[model samples]
Target chain A: MNLIPVKTRILQKNENLFLFFIEYAEKNINRVIQENSVLVISSKIVAVSQNRIMNILDIENKESVELFRKAVIDEADEILVDKNKFFLTVKNGVVIANAGIDKSNSKTGEIILWPENIQEFADIFSEKIKKKYALKNFGVVISDSRVTMRRRGTVGVALNWSGFWGVKDERGTKDLFGRKLEVSTVNIADNLVSAAEILMGQAAECIPFVIIQNLDSGLFTNIQQTHKSAEISQEEDLFQISSN
Target chain B: MNLIPVKTRILQKNENLFLFFIEYAEKNINRVIQENSVLVISSKIVAVSQNRIMNILDIENKESVELFRKAVIDEADEILVDKNKFFLTVKNGVVIANAGIDKSNSKTGEIILWPENIQEFADIFSEKIKKKYALKNFGVVISDSRVTMRRRGTVGVALNWSGFWGVKDERGTKDLFGRKLEVSTVNIADNLVSAAEILMGQAAECIPFVIIQNLDSGLFTNIQQTHKSAEISQEEDLFQISSN
Candidate 1:
């Protein structure tokens, strides 16, 4: 596999990211990426592009805001209020202050929710790329940098995916001695995004996109969808929590 | 990030793996890799190569096994007996049978302990790889498949590493908006290994060694030498006991 860092500019607060990518990939992406290659995009860029910014002032000093503030102060290690009413936090293994609220990047002062719809966005983006490039085995991954509550720093996770097999496994495949494997399925996108995130640094890498090639395209099933958050629970997480 | 699946046909139970890798990489590995690129090896293969297999027959019908059996039978979904001594659980997220005992893959039916010294072996492997290829920036990672007590499935954890940075970012770096990033440095190697293991399926895909390149070498640091296990108290673990 070849790791091609997508050389894109740092996203601004209210920039239109989808249009930017359409123009950039058309002009700048290398031709070497065959129909079988995969493109990985940071979820932060998607969130920013979709205008999912939230503002704290607009939250109103109501019961919800009061409760939220109390929770923030109690749970978060650090918090900051940007000029645009955007609250940021390095808490609970996440960087989005106010849990990904925004107002500066949205139209008007209202906060745009997490992409209005992430699955729709991923499908549209994937379709556009496939149609434009005439590629059959291409995939688009909308990734986010998240912190585990107890673990340090951020690792990339696939918020939504398209044009790829989400997982692969052989539940009954035999081992070397002919014993069958009970239940083993690989989360392909999550793994790939994590690998690529190593190159896409959090603060100052300027790389928002990564192209991974030479993957086993057969592992994909051409389904575009969003992963359920319910599958991951704080209670089941071991590395993040300290058993004091 | 190049994924080169090193193909080596090992005769069943043949313990020596280093020879197989050297031969396979020299022949099947592509030329695109720089001589200085690093080779990341999973820990299971290392254990297997070190002949760390355990059999059930060797373990006497002792009190420890009986006690562990009683304690785990209610919790374990399925129990597997191999060679009469080792008792492996299907999905308990714990790799050790009889609370981590056995001796199958060692000489004369003796349990070859978790690599006599992991870091030392890693260092030696790193030096050999660097010397053979005349490479300046290369590393070796020995990974193991471990199940955290409360989590689902088996995820690969870094057992030992050489010629690589284990973790990056210190506790006190500034965030994008100039706020101090307390406890933000990430465990780059462990996360990467976990991601890679997703593709290196437990039973199906026999690809042991994966080549990782184009990573920001600046983030690389010395491997973590400590083997301190996390102390999890029954009360502190939210999932340890159910009140319902």
Candidate 2:
């Protein structure tokens, strides 16, 4: 597997996503984008491109800090923790601090909300990428990082994906000894995102895109993708706390 | 980043981890070992090498079902959930189902315990690999995969690491707009492991090792590595559920 980070100048708000991609490919990765490659994109850039951004001072009747606080509450599906300095909220069926509203690396006094309808964005983006490159087997993943339970630093998570199966179902698969494996479905999208996140530094590095190559063509398909296969309902979650 | 999976025949119990590595390097990766590379290893192989195997029927006066149940309880620091088919336990300060005890991919009737003192093993393995290859800097990560909350498929986790700082701290770093980034530490070890996990396939794939090249040398350090550097105490944990 080859992971290549695409560095860019600071992305401007409402910039064209596909155009920026083309500019980068033409400038840096000319002729390198190939079939069976996966593109891992930072969701912040997509959100900015969608104009999913907020300015603290623009809201009425609240201080700057309170404005940020209100945004978290407004966007959160559920607020799990309300710490003095941090908010852990469930957004789009996943627990993300502040509903994945990124404040850093943006224009001062502005925050980028998690991109809306990310699945649609990824689906559209994949079409544009594949059409421009004339590639049949390609994948696109919109990604972000979150702190998992009982862990210190953040781990990558796929917000949405297209052009391939995000999770590889390994049910009924045999192990080395021909015995059925247990709970072995692999989350390929999150894995790819996490790999790309290392090169996409969280602070100050302007790399918002990553190109991954050397994938098994089996991972790609024209089948439409959905999150249902990768989601375990709250009632069925194995690690759910009853009170939650 | 270049990730090269080293496929091997099914590893045997009590095999020397370092010797097996030497054999693979001589046969396949004769001269590709270099400084600033990370070797992501599946913890199961390390546990097997350590002879951390147990037979379910060996315990006296207990049914096989009861013996497996007892093992889960004995190994867990705290068993958070006890279900008919699954056990969610906190082992070594992290939430892992069944205390990271793996049953699949093993000889029938045997289970592999999560290797004891993994940091020590990683440290020793790093030393042997570095000396053998005469590399100035290298890293070793003991890895596993787990299903995160609300997610269906498993994502990779680093149980322990050696020869580098696992978390790259960006505590006081400025963002693109010169604003201090928030909660911006990068978990490099987990990221690398997660990347390798995609190629390391959870079932039937005989690839137990992944060599990662093309890392920034600044990530390596002579400072001693410790879990404490990456751990957040229960008191300091932001995602804490007070009732627990």
Best by DockQ: 2
Off by over 4 Å in 2: A58-62, A242-244, B57-62, B242-244
Q: Score the docking of each candidate (DockQ).
A: 0.21, 0.72
Candidate 1 off by > 4 Å? A26-28, A56-114, A148-153, A229-244, B11-14, B30-36, B57-116, B145-156, B170-183, B221-244
**Please, what are the lDDT tens digits per residue for candidate 1 over residues A1-244?**
6657776765776676666776565566657556666778876677767655555443445754654465455444445332222234533223444444322223332443445466677788778877877878888776655432223344455656788865554567765435565445456666667677777765545567878776666855575445542134554432332222
lDDT by residue (tens digit), candidate 1, B115-231: 446677778887777777777777777665543332234444565666766556644654344434333445566556765675566663576787766556664544443322211
Q: Please give, for residues B100-215, the per-residue lDDT of candidate 2 as tens digits.
A: 98888888888889999988899989988899889878999999888777788888888888988799999899988887776698888889999999899978888889999989
Residue A9 local lDDT, model 1: 62
Candidate 2 global CA lDDT score: 0.84
Share of real contacts kept by model 2?
Answer: 0.75
TM-score of candidate 1 to 2 decimals = 0.71
Deviation of model 2 at B35, angstroms: 1.3
Residue-level lDDT of model 2, residues A55-98, one tens digit each, is 88533234877888988989988888777457777777666788
lDDT of each model, Cα atoms only? 0.54, 0.84
TM-score for the first chain in candidate 2 comes to 0.93
